[model samples]
Target chain A: MAQTSTLDRGGATPSAPARRPTAPRRSRGLPAWAVPYALLLPGLLVIGGLLLYPLYQMVEMSFYKVGLRQIRPNPRPAEFLGAGNYTEVFRSELFWSSLRNTVVFAAVTVALTLLAGTLVGLLLHRLGRAMSTFVVVGIMAAWATPPTATAVIWKWLFDADAGVVNWALGLLPGPLSELIFGTSDWSGRPWLNSPATIYLVLVVAVVWASFPFIAVSVLAGLKSIPSELYEAARVDGSGPVTTFWKITFPLLRPVFSVLLVLSVIWDFKVFTQLYVLAGGTTNREAFNLSLWAYTEAFSAPPKMGFGAAIAVVLTLILLVITGVYVRQIVRTEDVR
Target chain B: MEHVSRVLTRGIAGHSVWRYLLNSAVVALGTVLAGSVVALLAATAVARFRFRFRTTFLILLLIVQMIPAEALLIPLFLMVRRLGLYDQLLGLVVVNVGFTLPFAIWMLRTFVAAVPKELEEAAAIDGAGRLVTFWRVLFPLVAPGLVATSIFSFITAWNEFVFALTLINDQGGYTMPVALGFFTSQRSTDWGGIMAASTLMTIPVIVFFLLVQRRMVSGLVAGAVKG
Candidate 1:
């Protein structure tokens, strides 16, 4: 009876040694969901305190009659001008023109980037490994260059006088005099002064600076595709174009969509390129929303409230685009 | 040989090349170092701890990232001015760290999490302390992540222009971006010089990426596909 009792206790794990095994596991505690949140609190607080507060202040400023004068002590209360600033902004012809320009710029830039990126990605897919590596390096190099530097380089190249572009144009088959010194002499035609020309120049500069990023991202997407798909397609006697259209394109659609949405948001808020290229002045016709906001805030009399309103609008636009994109990304992730 | 000769003749050279190289190196290195420290700490915390508001923090980070650098210029400028850091490398570093911290942390977190918990547990069983376990046993496993995140931070800080333009005023303190701006305003806007400057600016980034591109590619693929 004593032997049987000892054996049962050892087997059933009612003794101290049996409990010891479970103690370590219990000591670690549950996979506490709260712990992750606690860890995240500090970062969240910092972002909220710094970024979100300023954003809130901007929103508050937009609804009031605030300006350069308001930066100092004033007797007059910041008048609760409900949507007055928004109304003024919406009614302004400059505002409308700038809005149109912004839309056009974002659309064109995103379209060009996606198309160029996709083509480059396809090329990388088809090319030999050595060549692909070389191209990838080149693309990364371009992507990594300072935007301001690229802007400067592009502006120099497009300069009317003693510019490399003009010099090259002088060599092309044409009336050399006409090409270099046209009826409207190249030097006389200020590229930055004309609204249409300035827009084109800005587009070119932005495209050159941004396309490399899209290319790299697309390349990443391309690399994920299994090689067997290509083999399967080839066995079915599908041409290269058809194979890409059916097999590769479908697989890459998710990444392409995400890239498209991100590029749109990014392009819409582009300020430096426009600011540098335009020399931080409104051309009336060429100005975009970002430049418009900057001008409103920093120009004479300094309508900080109006500027804030414009920024608010821009933020809302970005938020809406991001929301849609995030939903799509989340849905795709869930499905997978 | 003709192409080489043409490039040499037409490229930005002489005194400007040295200046450009110096400016870019200073800004890139300073920003990268500052940004990496913040990223490393934040990423480790996020990976190791399970606290309340973790999801909110992640979401907030994504949102903040969408708030284009352009939008932050006014606030950042005001803050910098108030802090008396205007036109300084320290100021640039602060802003670069702020701008880069979110993405760096996000990227680094994945790497930190990729490390097996059992390794740390085994180290603990061997009487190693938490810090010792982290530093000695787990650090090497996430070395690739560190490289990847650092590359990102370096690239971003190096390429930054808007805030640098708005914040930096003194030519003596100018970074590459600001220097490029000055180059733009100089008489004649030398195309060759500008191109040469740009080409030079692009080189270090290219080299860095080349060195780590394989690791980055594999890391990204593993994280996205496998996760």
Candidate 2:
């Protein structure tokens, strides 16, 4: 019932042949069975070679001691170090803290993004058409802004000196500002200096950039539900809260689940924004798994195998998180 | 405003900035063109045919999509180097294509399914060969979805920072995002110039997003609903 199908049919009508003759499917140079395989060959090669093979390589490298020398064109033999890299990663305090950062950030971001996004989606559903379009356009701009630009803009906003955040805080009543920060003077207060404050800024930036897609998606889901359900609930004397819990939430559960999983996957691996906010590996305290892996592998004195171990650990965690959802999707989809 | 404009002018007029912008554009365009073809073909196969391993392929696409690109970074970096594509734009393009293909194929499958199979059947009945029917009937119908996927691919490639940062070490090969990162990390940072450059980088993505957002949303919803 989506607009895309209607659009596709309408677009195809011009070129679609009118006469319906009765002829069987013909096998020309290629057999009918071979056609799909032919089409899929290029994609299979790319995915197999680039994605799957690298995944195997990452796991394989984790079991060996790969270094810059081992990975060079004229490579040295990598020594097998069964579980050595993993033991190094597991014992390291940095890995534990980075894992905590990754998990906590993802948990907080996924929850807040869903809450804000669903609220905006409901608001959009209730608004007038013109106003809905206006708000959607505004939200779309936020969603479409590149992650790097988003991080930079937020960084500038929270800059210690001459930032709008401090300026606005200073404008508050002296007593209020004093109560909040223990001083009315808000200038030269570094927001990105500490891991806590850095993550606060990051949470704000990430949630701002991400919620729009969820909002738009939830809005589309909302539109698909029959209004008659709401009407029937109204007739049954259901309160707005009851109606939402009983009807809206249940109807949109599938959409919500998909969005939640996708958000978790994205937020857990947040690198670019953290890279910008933490200003590279300088503030090791703010490192997430993605950034930690990158720094470990690529920075001076590269520990390629150690980084691969971290990445493998991260991937395993994500797989555990999404395994059930993937199973459910495969079960529901009639891919026979 | 005048001071801001001066800083913006300085930022926008840098030769290195132009090179970065061009690099970004080339990589993004290459991803779009190459990704669309690969995805479109794969999507058609998954949607239209009941081949062996079809379900497994679908599952693989989902699994690949879920894996963080960062996880593959080290090995892919090595792979690119082994293939003599390191520090090259072609290498970046190939990486982007690989990363973007899973989502594109997954999303485009829904678009392909949205086109009624009867059209192809009708074309076949009219003595049109399989290639003819696919080219004449299926491709046009899938074009809108292709646009949506291309836009997604373009934006993803444009904004990609990590792979580009790690893969291409040469200053001349740096993309816009990498250039912007370098700009921010400088000791004497030009805030106004950085802000201006960031805004410049964001404009194209926003414009394209706004143009097709409605269709894209519906397309996304359709996919989610079907799944």
Candidate 3:
């Protein structure tokens, strides 16, 4: 490193000019063209081994007969089951119900998240900077909290005996509470026990966590829209609702699409919140695809093959939904 | 609110919530430390250089971002166990890095690109070598963007649950989010303790948000609007 030492000694001089690379310096050690690959090496290896390889294995495992006996010590080799796992997965009633639950949960949550997120986004856009910042920070707290933490918070909020929701309901006039929800008894309502009510709570938690992203995205989109458009609408004496439908919605269509596809993918695979809320695999009927797959593979006498099948199905569904969205994105990118 | 301070004075599953806090800190910080370096190097490369697979690389990062981490749960757990990293905080860090690295690199590239190329040439013209030039000139310029990416990694790793649950079987190794899961069961629920633990888990993220809130909004909007 004489060259290095010389450079250092030279660099110690405050007036030294930074050395410029010429022909000889360009030929040193690694070629310039290989530098990018070198930079990408570590990240690619970690992701490939951990993400891509495991994904391939997951799909492969779906085609095998992978029970506990095949996995533990003194293990027997796994036998290839071809479409056997798929047949079983398709035939199982629980699988259908879980799939149904996944679809319904996704549909409802996506709609709610977009609707609420857009409203919040518009509110944030329309408000004074100080008020917007205040609300954005408030919403950011919910968004930044860990998913499991959000679940815990909401679970407490809906607690049957001590929950604020029930407590507030109790404060409402007794006959009104009875006539509206058909339950005057707000305390000890067992909100998490039933599937329908649990989904209601789940929707709240998912929407609460999700809306901030959409809000921020839409706000950003709104910020990008020219003031001229709004001024033009004002000049035409357009009403606020008409202006939103004619200008805002059409302009934000791409952002909405991205948000919709993402929300669908996220909501369909929801696991931790449901798992925490349900307390385990005990509530079979409340299962979403992700949790259902986890239980199928990792529950006692783990049926890994069947679990893989469920995952395969889940991945395929997501791929199809994401496919259409990606095509839209790609086409737009091409146009740009 | 009471539960937050209550946790400060109580333990859960035979360990203080402080232990889980320590575990989460290890994972979060470790992920940020390792994830940011790799991502920064890659981002600098992708941002400055015209490489053969440049567009493909950027697109791959977006595709990876889209893949649901949950779909890989069973397999990632198996990989961690096979590596003999199960029930370990290091495993959590590694997985977090892998998942978050693409996003970090992708975001940081925008920041790196925004830095003028002439600055690098000027640094070279000033006697600084490759690494020093980067540290002296590029690093400070990109620090705001790097901070944004670091926060993202910290939050993602800190709050991650499913991997923590499956990877760390032992109670002692559990992250706070996983521990929060244990507070509820079919037989009984510890609402107070759970609330306390969850609140504790959320504090660092909120504090972090306040620190970087303004830059993060502008950085995200600038990069994503055209996108």
lDDT (tens digit, per residue) of candidate 3 on B1-227: 67667666666677778898899899999999999999999988888777687777776676666666777877887778778888899889988888988778877888998898878765654655566777999999999899998987888898888888888888888888877777655224567767677778888989998888777766655444333
Q: Could you list the chain B TM-scores for each candidate?
A: 0.85, 0.92, 0.92
The candidate maximizing DockQ is 2
Query: Model 2 off-target regions past 4 Å?
Result: A1-26, A175-180, B1-14, B187-189, B224-227
Task: Quote fnat for model 2.
Answer: 0.69
Which runs in model 3 stand beyond 4 Å of their true positions? A1-23, A173-186, A332-336, B1-6, B125-129, B186-190, B220-227
Model 1: per-residue Cα lDDT over A1-336, one tens digit each: 111222334434433443334324423543435434444455555466557766777788788876655654343566789999999988899888888999998999889888887888788877899998888777756665667766776666667775566667656565655756464333434567677777778888888777766776777777788899899999999998899789888988877777788789889988777766776665667788888877777677777788888888888888888886766556554311
lDDT of 3: 0.81
Residue A263: error of model 1 in Å?
Answer: 1.3
lDDT agreement with native, every candidate = 0.69, 0.85, 0.81
A113-181 per-residue lDDT for model 3 (tens digits): 999999999999989999999998889778888888888778888888878898887776778767767
Q: Which scores better on DockQ, 2 or 3?
A: 2
Candidate 1 Cα RMSD (Å):
6.8
The candidates' DockQ values read 0.25, 0.55, 0.49
